[model samples]
Target: MRNLHKIKLLYEKYLNRTATHEEVEELFMLLRDRNQFQHIHNIMEDEWERNDIDFSVENLSWEKVRSEWPTEQKISDVREMPIEKHAIWSLKIRKIVAVAAGVLIAGMMLWWWTKTNTKEYRTGFGETMEIVLSDGSRVLLNANSKMTWNTNWQNIQERTVQLEGEAFFEVSHQRMPVNNSSPDQKDSISLMPFQVITSDLSVNVLGTSFNVASRRQKTDVFLKSGEVLLVAKPPLPRSKNDEKKTAGPSLAKHMDSIYLTPGDHITYSGITRALERHEEKLPDEPTSWVDGFLVYENEKLETVLQELKDIYGKSFIMEDSTMLSRQVDLGLPYEDWYTVSELMSLSLEIEMEENNSEITVKKLEK
Candidate 1:
């Protein structure tokens, strides 16, 4: 029998948000153990009764919770557990999930933990890095970006990675024999889909190059060389009222999945709850930053300024507001802020006054 005291402490740590990664994994594993389910269930119930919060699962449907756990063992656990016990389990789930945003979902944590071979890469502001996966795929991670994937893919069916911020992917095509196939069928190979998942959408491709950016509640995908399948959903409602309104309806007729060809660009805005697809004549502009430069083709001066602000934390004020609306085509290196400012001034015929925190732009003196 597992130690009840240790389990309780781990659960308490999880609720307190003080659990280490291994502790969190251990707690979830303990909860999934069929042999200790009764003991753990009783402990949770006792703990809930002791707490004074008005935590309720009365409005939550059991089917919804069951659907979250796809594995047969978890499903069996849900089926056999008494209805009242599900309430406690759901409450625990809600508390665990409420701990943070951008963290892995609790339902999938067990699977992630079991694999225990996941790897993550990250880059800081004004910095870029290159990553090579085990499958010979290459990724150029942009500044302020993060990507994670399971390192051990020998047994996994789909090759998947979770990404935040922006990155350019050069995914290598890989194939495996179909599961449950006979010896004669070993010659048949099927392409394993490579998926890049973000907060707003997922891109599925095989042997393709693409760029993905997810930031500030918006996701953008640009297909460079091959096709990609984009799957998107509306942002999860934050408040109870939002849940009531957005819970029952699908947002768009074409929102579920979209197939993108080369040069196809897609944007999904969480704030507006909309997905838009457009064609870009110059696909290289979207990924020029991968080469340590920002390339803009007929982009607004204001948009260019915002990119500067986002990348270098340098704010800009345009005294000639009309310049903000004027579209400009330009390319600037990422590392040199002074050169960027000079180029912007020369290109727009404006003078930039720079301070520690902000830059003011004015019409050039004759």
Candidate 2:
């Protein structure tokens, strides 16, 4: 049997977050000990169900037991009789079991507390949000997106966040530790490294502004200013049956990293794991949908319609590819749904009708 008083004090320290590093290490070691693990687990399970603890607070006391005694030994001394007494020995065992259970319960509660309190932010459909990070960097989250970081974000060893969907980042300039030399070069002062992970690629930046667009199966990254390193990771491996029957080209294992300068864009084609770089002058319109409209430059009607469908969630079915092909130039205004539809109709000489909330484009057929 273990000492109930000592276990209780150690658990108190853990709840307070005042336990020394050594003390935490010892407590976890005790938890894994086969002889004590089960008893500690039971005690903790019972206490959590009986009393709710406010996890956010820095300090907590077991409300039921707090005022009764200062130390577990004091309580035990009062409740226990001489060890020679049969009843006393039995009582001591019971108390030990109860304390063990408490320890187990507290450990589990602490795990849940840490997970639940972590900072998480998400955007819904047709919605977008902008955030100013602790370091004065900025992030603009697109619709149906999520971003998360630790609560102690400013103090963490590394500044990091998990991004899903799409976002644009403007990182703050801060000196970060760097290696003395690259394997291929001599030592020099290198800037702090920042990273953006997507389904298709991982972007490493040293204080720069960029946009990341990652869908479930595709990813696109565009660098607006500063330099970035783009690395493409291989897709997850498939099972034997899946591998044997696969139809397309074999996935590449080595990642291809390309140094991107301003005005460069890299797109990953999901099927091939091949990266295509566009060096042409980027469009003058705002790449970010939140700030301004996207104007197509002499784009085909079909292409313009496809772009609108992506942003506005409205689909257009062209009856005559010939009419769409004949109209070589078209423009679709964003921010106003009706105006975009009207413009499409006037420019293409076609009528648009909404059926079951979906737009269908049809030519006069004359």
Best by TM-score: 1
Q: Model-by-model lDDT, in order?
A: 0.73, 0.61
Model 2, 1-366: lDDT tens per residue? 565445645665765457898987677655543345456545454444444432221233456334433367755765565656746544444444445445455566556545753567787645678888776678988766788754444333345666777788898875644455576544444555567777676777878888887764667788889888766676523445433323244235555455677777767755577655555433433363646555655556775665565555676776666655553454444355677778767866778998754887887455
Q: What is the C-alpha RMSD of each candidate to the true structure, in Å?
A: 12.4, 12.8
Give the Å shift of residue 139 in candidate 1: 0.4
Instruction: Give the alpha carbon lDDT tens digit for every residue of 1-366 in model 1.
Output: 446788878867776678899997777666553345456556555655666433333334455544543377865787688999877766666653433211233335445554566898988767789899999899998877889987656666678899998899999989887765688876788888899999887888999999999887889898889888776765432344334222244445634555677887778875686766655557678898988789888888888887677666687887878988988888788776777788878877888888896889898989
Error of 1 at 103 (Å): 19
The alpha-carbon lDDT assigned to residue 166 of candidate 2 equals 75
Which pairs of residues clash in candidate 2, taking residues 3 or more apart in a chain or in different chains?
A: 40-100, 42-101, 43-101, 43-102, 44-101, 44-102, 44-105
As a whole number from 0 to 100, the lDDT of residue 66 in candidate 1 is 47
The TM-score values for the models, in the order shown, are 0.63, 0.57
